[model samples]
Target: MSLTDSEILLLEQLIHDREVDKLFSRLTTITEETNPNYKLLFEAINSQKWGFNDKNRPVV
Candidate 1:
């Protein structure tokens, strides 16, 4: 199956948002000098998400 232009754009936006969410979460922890949110911490990062597991589910 093929995605239309808008679907592709939305997919790109979702990926970007997920990455930004985790980055912001990480930054907040760093600024506070505290432990990370383990749930977010354990989820495969952007680089690893594709191959990590349960490939059907979206990364965020």
Candidate 2:
């Protein structure tokens, strides 16, 4: 079965949101930690800009 354009778009959005949510959760956990090793990882994830690309696809 083929998905309609809207359905495909919705699915893509859901996936993107889930990934961002996971990243945010990880970031939160890292923030709560005292280990300095996580600092760089937290910074990297925090500095990442998430948005849709020109093709309307999610970019992380």
For lDDT, the strongest prediction is 2
lDDT of 2 by residue, 2-56 (tens): 9999999999999999999998877677554546878887778789999998999
What does candidate 2 score in Cα RMSD to the true structure? 10.8
After superposition, candidate 2 runs with Cα above 4 Å error: 31-60
Q: After superposition, how far is residue 50 of candidate 1 from its true place, in Å?
A: 42
Return the TM-score for candidate 2, rounded to 2 decimals.
0.51
* lDDT tens digits, residue span 1-60, model 1: 999999999999999999999988875454444545654654435337343346666543
TM-score of 1: 0.48
Best by TM-score: 2
lDDT for position 2 in model 2 = 95
Model 1 residue-pair collision total: 0
